[model samples]
Target: MTEQALLLVNLGSPASTEVADVRRYLNQFLMDPYVVDLPWPLRRLLVSMILIKRPEQSAHAYASIWWPEGSPLVVLSQRLTDAVRPYWTEGPVELAMRYGEPSIEQSLVKLAKQGIKQVTFAPLYPQFADSTTTTAITEARRVIREKRLDLTLSILQPFYDQPEYLDALVDSVRPHLTQASDHLLLSFHGLPERHLHKTDPTGSHCLKTTDCCQRAEGAVLASCYRAQCLQSAAAFAERAGLAAGQWSVSFQSRLGRAKWIEPYTEAHLEELAAQGVKKLLVMCPAFVADCIETLEEIGDRGREQFIAAGGEELQLIPCMNTHDSWVQALVTLCRRAPQAL
Candidate 1:
């Protein structure tokens, strides 16, 4: 039997709340071409400017949510890794971050040393995006080539429309949905409009019409982040028994001057509140773990904004972090991943 291992990768967090640490982490994260998506010179210049003050503000936000053990993302990811380990059965389970410590390089190297012949590279993003999924895949391939590691990688493709994934999402959040909130906002992390066009295999298929995502089919839909998100949200709503008016979709975490996918979460918050929604429930389907984006960005800042906007309460439904159903679902996904020679 071939010795196999499961490796899970996620978006990394800063080593600490310190300004220097946040700056270092942000620099690595933003410098990736897939992320900033600019010419080398222009990207460097833009990121340099962003580094100056964004770090301090980000550091403060990190400080606000930092766990006693470590960054909540790192901690929660490890917990998920631990929970899934026993089920892998094939071999050991390891967790790595796309950026920062415990990187893909380090994890691959460790697996090689353990005499692992076949490894599954799972980028923990349900929806396919060049920035998150592509960068991680590129990094893993880079390590294999540069370091000459003798490991065969079976990559896990995006599971946006996978039945197991949709089922797990609904099962995990059912508890939160039990309470009747005025509305449920399915908020996914926003992507610049250009990203949608850039990833479209059929360039003319995306963002060309008002309902391109709805009309998209086959390859166009496969590469479309927005289409995949909408699919996931709609599937989850149906499985969770949410009515039409009970739930809506929006995009969050817009950065820079670039236009991102709309019904922006920030604006949507106010819209819901103004429409006499006294109680609002927000779920970040973009992230499987509750990181700063879900915890601080939505839970903390979002809650404040919603209440101030005349809403009585705003509650963030936690991600399916370490939930037994999610763990089982993830293992099933990994087992079904196609192998590469």
Candidate 2:
């Protein structure tokens, strides 16, 4: 029997809070064609323009959330990796970042050197998107081909609606919902609308209407990010005993001017505030690890914005980072994943 390895990958963070480090990270992140989805010249020009002042501002945002140990994203991911390692008796477990250090290339090479021929390439994204899942898988394949590594990959599909994943999410966040709150917001990360259509195999099904996601099925549902997100929220709400009106879904972290899935989170905060929801609870189900987006973007800035808009308070339910349930759920998912090559 051949040894089977597990490699967990996440959206990376800047190596440090320094502007230079942030710039490097952002450059690598935004320059990816899957992320920017533009022609080389156009993407380069757009990214270059963004690099001008975005890095300094981004550095400040990262600094606000920077854990003393290092980036919260990386630190928490490593912790999750550590927690899962003890349970994976078949082979070694490694962690990698999509854009930064301990890259997919480096992780694969390390596994190959250890005589591990089969790897379960798990991208820590609940929802499927070209920018996240596809890009990570693409890079792994690219490295395997370009470098001619002998390792074979068994990729884990997005587990957005997996029972184990939903169980972990509900169990982890149930306590937060029990606290006094007027509304619960399931805030998933935003993606450009074009990305959805570009990925739509049906081409005519996605973004067709306000209720299109509910109607999504078969091939469309499998590839639809919005549908998967809505499904995750619906399943979570059902399990948590949240009434339809008690919780609503919103998309966050919109970038550039391109139309993104909405209602936008920032605007939704004000909407909820205006509706006289005095206390609010927000859960970013899209992310399993609490990173700058969750900590600073939502926990910090979002709280200020919500409070200033007449809401009394906004609580950000933390991600299931290294939670015991999540650890076990992840192990189950990995064990059940389809093995390849």
Candidate 3:
């Protein structure tokens, strides 16, 4: 067998809660073309303006969620990689962040130095998105290409609707789903409206009508983030035995004032409270691992909002961090036969 390396990638977090560290992290993350999608000059200006004050606010959130071990997202990602590496005797596994210290370049360099020629990049996002999955792949390729290293790379496809992926998702969340809950809100991260339009092949389907995303098929469904997000939610609902009116979907962690897909998670939480829904179960199917968004935003701030608006309990179902099923599902995704690039 050819020597190989498995590179697991995820959206990164600051090394610490220091404001400077958080600011630098945000700069790298937001500067990516796929992420901000603004022209260079305008993007720089906007990001600069954001950096002036947003870092302090972000620092506080990161502080509140900071685990003793480290950032929960980074820690869980490493744990997943550590578990999977032992199973794959054919290759060693390494974790990389597209925008942090243990970065794509750092991981690639170490592997290249070790004579690793073939690499499989498992972008942790279950859904396809230009910002998350696409950016990670592009950065990996850039480092390999720029260094003129001998490397063979393959990527994991979106597993939002895959059976094993869905099964693992259900397996991880099943323990948390309660018959006493009035509704299950499967919240996903938000992307700006333009992103949906940009990825839409027909340029007519996404944002065309509310019904377009509801019908998940064709190229749009395959690549459109909105479609895949919805698909994951629906599949989880079905597999978890959630009946109609017992489950709903919303988008969370939205940034900067552009219109993102709705219903927004915070607003929806308020609405659910007003509608006499008392017990709400919240799960972030979009994120396989828990992070600041899930821990502090949803678990802390979101819970406060819901209760303040007249709801009893808003429990956050933990993400599939190092769950056995999720780890097994990840191995399946990496070891499965490769698809054509």
lDDT scores of the candidates, listed in order? 0.94, 0.94, 0.89
lDDT value, residue 276 of candidate 3: 96
- Count of steric clashes across candidates, in order: 0, 0, 0
Can you rank all candidates by lDDT, best first?
A: 1, 2, 3
Q: How many clashes show up in model 2?
A: 0
Q: What is the lDDT of candidate 3?
A: 0.89
Tens-digit lDDT track for model 2 on 264-284?
999999999999999999999
Report the lDDT tens digits of candidate 1 across residue range 198-274: 98887788898899999988999889999999999999999999899999999999998899999899999999999
Give the distance in Å from residue 326's predicted Cα in candidate 3 to where it truly belongs. Answer: 0.6
| Candidate 2 regions with alpha-carbon error over 4 angstroms | none
Which pairs clash in the backbone of model 3? Answer: none
Span of ten consecutive residues with least summed lDDT in model 2: 332-341
